[model samples]
Target: MHNGFMRVTALALGIAGALAMGNAHASGFQIRENSVKNLGRANSGTAVAKHDASVVSNNPAAMVNFDRSAVQVDMTDINLDASFTGGGTTAIGTPLSGGNGGDPGSATLVPAISAVFPLSGAFDKVTVGVSVDAPFGLKTEYDPQWVGRYNAIKSDVKTVDLNLSSAIAVTDRFSIGAGLILQRADVTLTNAIDYGTAICTASVPGNLGASVANCLNPAYPFRPQANDGNVEVSGKDTSLGWRIGLQWKPTDHLTIGASHRSEIDHNLTGKADFTAPSAVAAVLGPRVADQSINAPLTTPSVSTISVEYDFNDAFRLMADYQATDWHSLQSVKIFTGGGGVLGNEPFQWKDTSFYSLGGEWDLSPAWTLRAGIAKDESPTNDTYRTPRLPDKNRKIFSLGATWNVSDAISVDAAYMRINVDDPTINGATSSSGSHLTGTFKAHADLFGVAAQFKF
Candidate 1:
C-alpha cells in the first residue's frame, strides 16, 4: 500500500473506537449555556432579549437595543446526578461481574463572554459584536470494571466557539443581523473488548465469521481462553459555521424575532491506543496496533422564534420555540483507508424541539426578578440507549434576579433544576458478539452568574 493510505488506515482506528461515546449525550450532544439571563428564562427570548452583550451570540440584531459599548461575562456550574439500573450487562468473556455503573455524568463548568460596540460616522446605524463560549460537550465516566465496561468506560467531547456579528436596523421597527462562527472540538473515549469474541473473525477452523455469539456457542473450541482488552481514542478538529437573525416590532409592547444557525462539519484526526491482555496480544498484536484515525461529524443546526410582550411597565413576558436538526447524526460509519471495516453505529436520531415561557418582574428602579419553565425533548430512543449517554425528555425550572449597582455596572444570577425521565435501554448490539442493556435515572442542577459593564 502507498505510505499515505497506510497513514490514514492507522488513524482510522480511533474514530471507529470512540465516535459512539463522543456523540451520545444531550440528544446527540447539544448545549445551551450562553447567558445567565437566558438560563433564568429557560432560554426564552434568547433571539430578541437584549439584557446584555451576550445577546450577540443568539441574536445580533438585538444589540441595537444597546446605546453604548458593553462587555458581559458569564459562568455556569453544572452538577449532574445519574446512575444505571436493570441487568443483562454481562460482557462476553468476563463472568457477569461488577456493580451498577455508578454516576454516569460529571460535574463541570461552562463559561461565556461577549462584547458589543456601536458604530460611528457613516456606520451610525450599524452595531458590531463578538462572542466566545462552548456550544457542545458532555463528560461521563464509569467504573473500569463495571458490567457495562465492555460498552463504555469514559466518554468526553467539548467544543469552543468564537463569533463575530454585525447588525443594522433597516427601519425604526425592523432589524437584520448575521454572524460568522469559528469552532474547535475535541473528544476522548475508552471501552473494553472481548478477545475471544474478536477471534471469531479469524479464518481458522471452528470460527464463525458473521454469527459469533461469544463463548456460549458450542461451535467455538477455545471459549475458555477468552480475555478482556481495552481501547482508548483521542482526537481534535476545527470547523466554521454561520448564523443570521431578524427582529421586528409591530406594536409598542410586542417584539418578534427569529434566528437560524448553520451546522458545522468537522473532520478530526487522531490516534487510537489498544492495550491487550498478554494472551490476546500474542496473536492479534499487529491488528490492534496504535493507528491514526479520522472521524467525520456534523453538528446540529437550530432555528428559533421568540416573542417578547410587555403587559405593562412592571411586567414583561417572553416565549420561545426552538427546533434542533439532530438528523445530522442519523447514523455513523467508521472504516480504514485500506478498506478495513472497523464499525458502524446506527443512530436513527429524530429531530427535537424545546419550548419555554418566562416572565420578568421589575420590582424597583434597580431590581428585577425573573422566572420560567421549559420542556426539552430527547431524540434518543429506547432501542439505542447506551451507557455513554442516558438521555431522555427533560423539564427545567428556573429563577433569577438582576442587581444594577449603577447604570454601567450590573450583575445577574440564576438557578435551575433539570428533571429527566427515567429511560430504559432495550439490549443494544456491539461489535462481534457483544450486547449491552440497562436503564438510567439522571438529573442535574445549574447555577449561573453574569456581570455586565456598559462603557
Candidate 2:
C-alpha cells in the first residue's frame, strides 16, 4: 500500500506540472490585442498614440491629450494554425504507437473597451480613465491518441485585466499617470498517463506484485501503450498589480512616452481528477482518487518606450520597443493541501524584446491609411519547447484604415499576418518517460475593428 501511494503521488506531481504550459497569441502567452488602432500598425507607438480612448490602457499619461470625454470599443479575431509532424516518439524504451496530432490551434475572439473623462473646475489638469481587456489567453486541443498525447492533449488558459487610471498634466509639456490593475486568471490542462510504465518503473514492489518482468510478458494485460489513463487539472485565481507612465512633448512634432507594468502573482487552488483503467485503479486505490491541488504562477512584467513623429499634417511616423521580464518565470512549483511540495517544473525562460515601425498617411478628408512591420522574440528555446506552446520567433505585417464618419464618431479597421519560424523539438522528455521529437509549422492572422465616440 505504501509503495502504491508513492507512485500515485509522483503521478499527481506530473499532472500538476502541466499547468506551466499555457499558449498565448503574443510572445510568452501575453496578449497585445487591446487596441485595434494600435494593431493596425503592428502596435507601433502604442505608448504614445493619443488618437483614441485606448490611451487609457496603452499609456495612461497620454490621456492628457484628450480634450473631452471619449469612449472606445474594439473587437479582434485571432486565427491560429499549428500542426506537428512527428519525427519519432517513445515511452519507456518502446516505440509509441499513434499518428501525428491534427491541428491543435483554434480561433479566438478578443474584445476591449476604454473610457476617458477629463476633470472639471479645480481639477481641470487631471483626467481619469478605465479599461477592460483580456491581457492573456489561448487554447490548444490535440487528438486524444496522438503520438505526443502523454505530453499534452489539451491546454486552455485565460486572463482578464481591469485598469483604473488617472493622469495629471504637471506642465504643458510633461504628463504623468498611474493605474491600479485587477486581474483574473483561469486554467485547464489534460494529458494521458502511462499506467503500464508507471507500474513497471515502480522503485518499490507494487500492491499486485507487478514488476518489470511482468510488464514485459506478452500475456500481461497492462503494458506500455496497452492500458492508458487520463488526468485533468483546473484552477482559477485573482490578483492585483500596478502600472505607471510618463509622456513628454519636447516639440510640436515629436512626442515620447514610456510605461511599466508590474508583475502579478497568483496562488491557484483547484482539483485534480483522474480516470484510470479498472485494473490499475484497483491496484492504486485511493491514491488515484480526486484531490485538491495548488500551484504558483507569476505573470511577467512589461516595459515599453514609444515615439511618434508628426512630420506634417498628412503624414506621421511611429516606432516602439518593448521588453518582457520572462525570466521571472523560471519554474513552477506545485504543492498539496498542507503546503507540501509536490514537484517543480523548470522553464528557464529568458527575457524577450519586441520592435515595430509604422506610419500613417491621410488619404483624404475622411480617410486615413496605415501600415507597419514588427518582430517578436520567443522566450523558450529548443530544450524547453513543448507541444503545448511550441513558440518561436515571428515577424508581423499589418495594414489598416480609419473612416471618419463624422467629427464625433470614427471607425478603425486593421488586419495583421504573422509568420512564425518553424520550430524543431529535439527529443524533449517528460517526467512520465515519454520522449517526443518533431517539427511544427505555425502561423496566425488577426482582424480587428474599433469604434470611438467623443462627447
- TM-score of each candidate structure, all chains considered together: 0.90, 0.94
lDDT of 1: 0.73
Q: C-alpha displacement of 448 in model 2, angstroms? A: 0.7
The sequence of per-residue lDDT tens digits that candidate 2 reaches over residues 1-455 is 22222222222222223322233357878888998888889999998887778778778999999998999999998888777887444445778777778877767788999999999899999999999998776777888988988777887777889999999999999999999999988877777777777766553334457667766788877677777888777778899999999999999999999999998888887877888899888767776787777887888889999999999999999999999998877777767676766445666789999999999999997999999999999887888776766788989999999999998899999999888888787776654567888888888889999999999
User: Where does candidate 1 stray beyond 4 Å?
Assistant: 1-26, 89-95, 200-226, 337-339
Output the number of the TM-score-best candidate: 2
TM-score of 1: 0.90
Worst 10 residues of 1 by lDDT: 1-10
Task: Please list all clashing residue pairs in model 2, or write none if there are none.
Answer: none
RMSD of each: 4.5, 2.8
* Pairs of colliding residues, candidate 1: 10-291, 10-292, 11-292, 11-293, 12-292, 12-293
